[model samples]
Target: MTPLDDGPPHGRGREIWLLAATFLVAAAGMVYELVAATLSSYLLGDSVRQFSLVIGVFLASMGLGAWVTRFVDRAVSGFVWAQIALGVIGGCMAPVMFFAYAWMGEVELPLYLFLVLTGILCGMEIPLIARVLKEVGAAAFRFENVLSVDYVGALAASVAFPLLIVPHLGLMSASLSFGVLNLLVAGISLWLFRAQVSRGLVVVWAVALCALSVFLVQSERMVSVVEASLFEDEVILSQDSPYQHLTLTRFQGRTRFFLDASIQFDSQDEYRYHEMLVQPAMALAPRRQKVLILGGGDGLAAREVFRSADVAAVTLVDLDGAVTGLFRSHADLVALNAGSLNDPRMTVVTGDAWAFAAENRDSYDVIIVDLPDPKSIALSKLYTQEFYAMLAERLSATGVMVVQSGSPLFARQGYWSVVHTLQATRNPFVPGGRLWVLPYHVYVPSFGDWGFTLVAAHPLTPRDIHLPDGLRYATPEVWRAAQVFGPDEADMPADVNRLQSHALVGYYSAGWDAWFK
Candidate 1:
C-alpha cells in the first residue's frame, strides 16, 4: 500500500546494500563486545572474571534490545537510529572507560551502562533490517541469509580483533575506528534512502561522524592523559602488545615496568627479586649446566643464571616477544639485565612456556619460573598441575626448579596454592613421582615479603644451598633465614591449582584485594 511496500525501482540493488550492511553491522557489533571485555580485563584484572561479566551483560542487553524492537512502527528509521547510537556509544566506550579508570576509579556502572546501551542498539540491527527488506518487498531477505552473513562477520571480527585491530590501533583508536565504520554505514544508508529517511536524522548521523572523527584523531594524546593518571611516574614508553599493555615509567633515574597496570619490577630493587628467584635453585641443583627460564622475558633471571660457572646453556621461554625484544634492545633494560638476553649461550624462545616445556625432550638442570602472578586464567594455567607436570618431565633427576610465588604476606593462600600445586605434579599416579618443595620468603622494599618455592627431586636444606659470587641481596645466611616464617606467615594448605577450576586466580585476587584494601 506504501511506496516502500510496492518496492523501489532498484529493489534488488537495495537488497544487496542491506545484506552488505548486515555483514558489517554484525562485525562491528562483535568488535564492540571484545573491546569492552579486553579493556575491563586490562584495568580490573582477573581476565576470566572481566570477560565473563562483560559478555554476560552484553548478551543479555542484546536480548532485551531485540525484544523491544517488536514495538517499532518504522523499520528504516529505527535501523538508522540504532546504527548512529551504536557508533557513538561503542566508539567512545574504551576512551571513556580508560579515562574513568585512571581518574574516577569507579567503572562498573558506566561500563555496564555502555555495554547495555550498545548491545541494545546492535540488537535492533538485524531485526530492523529484515523488517525494512520485507517492507520493500525483497523476499530474499530470509532469516537464514541474515544469520549466515552475521556469523561470517562475527568470525572476521574475532580474527581481526587480536591480529589487526588491537595490535595496530590500540583500544582507544580501535573503538573509534569501529564507531566510524558504524557511522559510515549509517551515512551510506541515509544517502541511498534519502527519500525515505528524514533530513533531521541525516543531521544526527553527520554530527556523530564529525565527533567520532575528532576523537579518533586525538586518541593517541588522550591515551597519554589517561596513562598519567594511572601511573605514578612519567610514562616514557608505552605499547599495546597482543598479550598485554606494556608501559615503562621513569622517575629520578629509576625506571619501572608494568604489564596490564601491575608493576613487574622497579629498577631499584629488581636485582633483589631476580637474585632470590634464580640463585637458590642454581645453588641447590646438582648441576646447573642446562637451565630453563620460563616467563622471565626481561632476561634478568638469565643474567643471574650466567653468573654461575656451572651453567652451560640457558633456554628462556616467555610468551610475549614484545617484552623480550624490548629488554634485548632498550638501553635502559639492557643495562638493568646487563644484556643477558643477548648472550649467545642464552636461547630465547618467544612462546607459551607450557608448549615449550611439553614439547621439549631435552632436560634442564635448573628451571626458573619468574612468571607474572596468576592474575588471569591464562597466567593461572601456568601454575596448574598440568603445567607443573610438564616442567617436571623436562627437569633432570637432580634438577631444581624455582617459582617466583607472590608475596607470602599479601597473597598467603595464593603462595601456598602454588606450593601445593607444584607438589601435586609429583603425584604417585603421575610419571614424575614426588618433589621436595621448600618455601622461602624475603622482604624486598619494592614488594614486601615476597615468596619463592624451590622444587627438587631430592630433599634439600640450607647446607645444600650454594650462593653465586657478587650477589647483592641474597647470601647463604639470608637464604637460610628466609626459610623461617612468622606465626602470621604460617602455611595454609590450599587446593591444587588446575586448569578446570582456576582456584588459584580466585585465591590470588582475593588475597591481593584484602592487602590493598
Candidate 2:
C-alpha cells in the first residue's frame, strides 16, 4: 500500500469536503465571467470586443492567482481555511460587481479589477483543496482520485451554469446563492475540524460567512436599485431572453425596448424615423410593387409600404422572431406599428438576412435596407459592400433601392461610403441608370439624432412614389428636402466605403462618441 494509504483508510471524507468547497467557488467564478461579458456588451457597445477582453483579463488574472498560491502559508489546515475564505469571496463577486457598477459613476476600471481578483481567488481554490485532502490522509499522490473529483466538480458546474443558474436566477441572485454555498462550506469546515483551528480564525470566518449569508436573501431589492440606476429610467419590465436581457423602460412619456441594454426602438416617435426611411424610396420607385423589407421587424415600415395599393407582396426578414412576435402579439407593440403587421400583403420570414439574401435571386422590385446600426461584427456584414452588391443583382431593371445609412452629418464617413458604394453599384442593367444619393435626418429621443441615405439608379419621378393614402411624416416636400445637403455639411471627404477596409465604421462610431460626449 502507498504511504498515503497508510495514514487512514481511503481519505474519502477529507476529499469530499474539499471538492464541495472548491466546486462552489469554481461555479461562482464561471458565472462571474458570463455576467462580466454581458455587462460589457451592454455598456461598452461591442460584443466581440467585450467578450474577448473579459475572457482575456479573466484568464490572465487566474494565472496570476495560481502563481501567488506559492506564498499561501505552508500548512494543511491553513490551505483548507484559505480555500473556504476564497470560496466565500468568490461567491459574492457578481452581486458586489453589480452594486458597484450602479453606485459608482465610472465603473470600467473597478469592474475589471474586481473580475481579475475573483478569477485569482477562484484559481487558488483547487490547489489548496488538493493539498488539504492529501495531508488529511489522501494517498501519498493518488493523482487519479484527486483529478477525478476535480473533474466531477467541474462537470457539475458546466451543466448547472447556463441550464439552471443564469436564466432562472439571473447574475445577481446566482452570485448571492453561491455566497450561501460558500458559507455552508465554511460551516462544514468548522464542524469537521473545529479542534484544529485557532479560536480567532474560527470566529472571524464564521462571522464573515454568516454576514454575507444575509445578502443572499436581500439580493432582489438591491438588484432593482442597481438596475434602475444603471438604466436611468423606470424599468417597467425586464427579462433575460437567452440572447440578451430584454427591457421595457419608460421616460418622459416615451417607451423604449432595450436588448442587452442597447435601445432597440424608442416608441414615442418611431413613426417619423420609419416613415422617413421607407417613404422616400417608395415615392422614388417606378412602382413599389414587390418590396423587400430588411430589419424593420416591428412592421412599422411594412405598414408604410402597404399604404401603396401598387405593392403586390412584402417580404419581411428579420433574425429574431422574439422581436417580430413582440410587435405582433403584444398590444403595445401592435398599436405602435398601427396594425400593419396584420395586413395580408406581408410575408414574414425569420432568418439571418445575410444568409437568406445569398440563396435567392431576381425577386424584389424595391429593396429597403433598414437594419440596425452596425454595433458589432455580427451586424457588420449587412453594412458591407458585398451585401449591397447582392442587393444590386436581386433588384429589377428599373428598380429603386434606398438604405438607411446610419447617420449622415454625424456618421459622415460611413454615410458617404454608403453613398459612393451605391454609386459604384449602378451598371448596364438599366443603361440610363445613374446612381444618386439623398441625405435625410430624424431625431430619436433616446438616440438623440439619426440619419439615412436614399439611393436610386435614376433620378426620382414625383409620380413613381405614389405614397400610401395615409402618412404621418413623409411628404413630397419632405422627400425633396431629404436630398438637400447644406454647404457646411458638404465638407466631409467623399471617400467611399469599400469591402476591404471598414474605416468608416471607426469614423462613424468616433464621430457619434464626440458629439454625444
Candidate 3:
C-alpha cells in the first residue's frame, strides 16, 4: 500500500473525509445499541437482563457483519449502502419498538431483529472504510487510524447518551437524530467518491436523507402518538428524565402517574394506598414531630404525614427531581398530593435513599419507606438487610418505621422477606437490641392485596394504633383487619435479601411472573 504522504493531494482529502465518516458512524452505532437496551428495560421489567441480552446480541451481530465483509468486492459502494441501511434501521428502531409494544403487547421479536441488523451494519463500516482508504492510496496506518477514531467516537456516544441524549433529546429523538447522522455520512461518502460511484446509488441516498430529515423534525409528535396509543387515557405529560421515563395520563377526572410504564399511582384511589402506608406508622410512633420519607417523590406519603398535627418538620428523599418537581409545580398533581410538597414544613432532598440514610446525622420520630416494588437489582438494594440496618440507625429510640412491601397475594415471599429482614435488624436502642417487625396488608382496587411492614424498638398491636379524622380509607377496623392473612397469603420460606445476594429481586420477579403470566 502506498503511504498517504506519497498519495495525490485529493487522495489525502478523501482519506480525511473517510476518517471523519468513520467517527460519526461509530458514534451513531453505539447510540443505537444504547437506545435499544434502554427501551427494552423500560417496556420490560428486569433492566439487568434486558441490557445484557441487548449488548450480547449486538456484539455478536457486529462480529457476523465483519466476517461477511470478506465477500464484498466493492468496498466503497458496500460502505455507502451500509450507512444508508443503518440510518433507516437505527433511526426507526425506537418508534417501531414503541408501536410494537403498544399494539402487539410484546417487543421481543422486533427488539432482537433491530439489534442484529443494526449491529451487523455497524460492524461492516470500519473494515469497508479501511479498504476504501487503501484503494485511495492511503498509508498502512489506515486500519489503526480508523479503529482509534471509532473507539473514541464510541466513548463519546456512551457518555453523551445518558447525560445528554436520553435526558434532553429522549430515546425517540436521539434515535432519529443519529439516524440522520448516518444518512449524512452516506451522502458525504457519495459526494467524495462521486466519480467512482453509480448515480443510481446517489438517488437512493438522497431519498433516504430526505425521509429521515422529516422524521427527525417530527420526532416529538411521533413519540406522543406512540405514547397515546399505549395508554388508555389521554397522555397529559410524557417526559424522559435522566433516571427514567415518566408518563402522566388522565381520564374521567382521574389522573395516573407511571414510571417506565409501571403504574405509580391512580389519583382516584391513591389516598387509600397513601393513608394505609402512613397512618399506622405515625399512630404507633412515640412522637410525630420530625418525620423522614424515602422514595415518595409524588408527595402522597408526605400528604398523609402532614395530616398529623404533630408533624412539625418532614424531610423527603427521592432519587428523581423530575418526579418531585412535577408534584410540586403541576396544579393537578399538587392538588392530588394536597399541596403537601409545597408546605413550609416539607424539605425535599433530591438524592438516593440509601446514600441519605448512610449519611444522615439526625434521628427521625418516624420513617416511611414508600419505594417502588423490588423488580430490579438497583431497587432490590433498598430492601436488603444492609439497607434496613442503615434505616435502623436513623430511627429514634421510640420511633417507628414502615416500608411499602409489594403485593402479599402476588408476591408472598417477597413481602415476607422484607418482614424477616427487618426483624433480623439489630438495633441497639430496642428492648431486645432488635426490631419488632409487624407485617400487614390492604386491598386497593388498582393494586389488590398490597402489603406494608412496620418496624419499631418495641412491640405494636392494632389496639395501640390511632386513626386521624377525615381519612377516606384507613380506620381502626381497617387497621385491625389488615393484620389478618388467609392460608394462601401466609408467609413462605425465604432467604434474607443482602446486597450481594439480591434475593428479593429474584423472589419478586418470580412471584409476579407466576401471577401475571
- Identify the leading candidate in terms of lDDT: 3
Candidate 2 local lDDT, residue 171: 72
The TM-score, computed over Cα atoms with residue i paired to residue i, of candidate 2 is: 0.82
Sliding window of 10 residues with minimal summed lDDT for model 3? 1-10
Scored against the true structure, residue 125 in model 1 reaches a CA lDDT of: 91
lDDT (0 to 1) per candidate:
0.88, 0.70, 0.90
- The total number of steric clashes, by the backbone 3 Å criterion, in model 1 comes to 0
Writing each residue's lDDT as its tens digit, candidate 2 over 1-517 gives 1123332334576667666665665665666677777667766766778889999999898888777778876444555465456556655666666667667745587668767877786666667666666666654556566556656666776677656676677777776676666556666766666555677877777777777767777777777777797786788777664455667777886788877667777876777787887877777777677999888887888877877778888889987776777778878767778777777887888888888789877567788888877766667667776777777777776777778877666666666666776676655366756466566666656565567776665565444244565676777766666656666355366555555666556766776786764
A best-first ranking of the candidates according to their lDDT comes to 3, 1, 2
Model 1 residue 35 lDDT score: 92
Clashes of 2: 4
Greater-TM-score candidate between 2 and 3: 3
RMSD of 2: 4.2
Determine which window of 10 residues in candidate 1 has minimal summed lDDT. 1-10
Q: Which candidate, 2 or 3, would have the higher lDDT against the true structure? A: 3
lDDT of 2 at 116: 83
Candidate 3 accuracy as lDDT: 0.90
